[model samples]
Target: MNKKILFVDDEENVLSSFKRNLRREFSITTAPGGHEGLEIIKNQGPFAVVVSDMQMPKMKGSEFLAEVKKISPDSSRILLTGYANIENAIDAVNHGSIFRFLTKPCSNEALISALHEAIRQNQLLTGEKELLEKTLKNSINVLTEILGMVNPAAFGRANRVKRYVNQIARLLKLNNIWKLDMAAMLSQIGFVTLPNHILEKVYHQEELSAKERNMLAEHPEIGAQLIKQIPRLEDVSQIIRNQNTDFSEHQKISTPLAPVQKFIVLSSQILKVVLGFDEMIFRGISKPSAMSILKRDKSKYNPKVVDLLEHVQISEKERMQKTLALAQLKSNMLTNQNIISLQGKMLVAKDTELTDPLIQRLKSYDVSVGVQQPIKIFV
Candidate 1:
């Protein structure tokens, strides 16, 4: 497919000339002024290149291209000026990071060459971004799989907490949901270093000695350290580190946090609320009673997050539920009853949120030990 290019100028004739000259060579879009060009870039963009005239009214070319750099950094920019002074060239190059600075009445051949080069640069930028994202996703999956195998109880809690985190995120209209989701999934990774009996006792709501409790308290930091080793996961690691921290403690800190850090703090608080509630359910407490207990210590959580969790939980209960064969189980269904193996071992706890990985693990268990039919799940 031909790469899309946008041309911006105050002069209607110049825009028309650009369209007439480059319409066949590329997918050409023209804007009469900088404001319209910006709007087009926002609404119909990811354009491979944006060419703007420097002398446009209302907004100058350098200023417009600077905004373009903020909104679409990978889209190569070019500044075309009829009066090309050294100052204009410097501003265009420094502020807009323009790939090319050309004089007005630029030859068609020069413009075409610049556009093609810009397209090549855009391809490189987008290609690297895609590859990095894919690699990160694959690495996360592999790590989570290892965690599940090594510590199913902690892994199950992670899955449950992730569901609540997602609901709270949606209710808050958050943009960085993947960070929240990943933080939830890997929040318990630190527990892998502890003995299996400690994890089992914790999962069963058994009391621990002071030393063991202190060791458990350090799991978040351990998890953060483990996750921080991965590239581009610094924010996620921070969220995991702070999952047990009270929101008020964060506010008491002297240094103000960045926007993303504030998000991590909020996400951490939400995870704490959900994990607390899940613990209550595991101990056989009724949902209403558990909610009341959580509400009594409202200062421990973000009020908005707790309220959203209640709302999401209520709405989720209204979904249709079914009892199906193990072979019919699907991802994203909540377990209505504990799935026990033939040997009377709990395969998955009630109220646990199902995921594809968990489902695949169950299938493997079936192949190895054979599962009974008719698993109860809430869709």
Candidate 2:
């Protein structure tokens, strides 16, 4: 793909001249001023390089480039102006994250060379970010998969809570949701330290001894410690640590959170509510009764998150339900009810999305031990 370049100047003639000079050599877009440049950055951004005149009316190039850095941090920024000074250069470099500063009346060859260098820098930055994210995601997935095998009850809760996390995130129109999803998946990783019998007791809602209760209560902190070892997972770890925290305690002790941190906390709260509901359902309580119990303690959760949780539940109920034979099941179809074996063990959890490997496993089970037929699924 051709690298995209944006040029912003208050002077129409300067912008026109840039288009004339560089349009043939690059994919050039021009904006009249900083405000228009910001608009383009929002609506049609991800540009390889953004060049802005330093002294535009209303908003300066430094401020415009700073906003661009927030919106598209990988986009290389350049400041071009006749009023170049040490102060302006410092501000542009520090605040605008500028890759290059050019004086007015710059030659075509110099500007072209700068643009080429800016594009290279943008590509390197974006490539590194993508690789880091991919590697982190794969590592998290492997850890969660191992946890799932070791303690299905705990990891199953993670899987179920992840569905609610995604739903609530979409309801709130949040971005970079994979972090929240990762937090949810690894929220119960600390349970790996406990014995399977202890987890089983917790899953079944059996009464616990004082020691067991203390250990159980420590799981969130333990999970946080384990996750914090991974780079770029500090926020995720903090979210896990706060999963069981009361809002009042959070308010008292925690530092002011960033938007992403706030979202992580919100996701953690939603997971608590959903996990409670899941436990109640496992104990044969009705969904409405479980939800009512959760709402009665309103101070424990953010009201907006609770409202969105309710909305998610309502939306889930409205999904198309069908009963199909094992041979008819397809990928991405969610289980509407738990699939149980003749021995009464749950083979698949409710709301679990079927995949090709899982389908094949179920087929093998059907042939070997015989699974219950006419499985219920949500379309």
Q: Pick the candidate with the highest TM-score.
A: 2
Local accuracy by lDDT, each model: 0.82, 0.79
lDDT of 1 by residue, 328-379 (tens): 8888787877777787777776666676877888899989996766887888
TM-score, prediction 1:
0.77
As a whole number from 0 to 100, the lDDT of residue 285 in candidate 1 is 86
Query: What's the TM-score of every candidate structure?
Result: 0.77, 0.80
Q: List the residue pairs that clash in candidate 2.
A: none
Give the C-alpha miss distance for residue 250 in model 2, angstroms. 3.7
Task: Give the distance in Å from residue 27's predicted Cα in candidate 2 to where it truly belongs.
Answer: 5.0
Error of 2 at 144 (Å): 2.1
- Root-mean-square deviation of Cα positions for candidate 2 versus the true structure, in angstroms: 3.8
Q: Mark the 10 consecutive residues where model 1 has the least summed lDDT.
A: 308-317
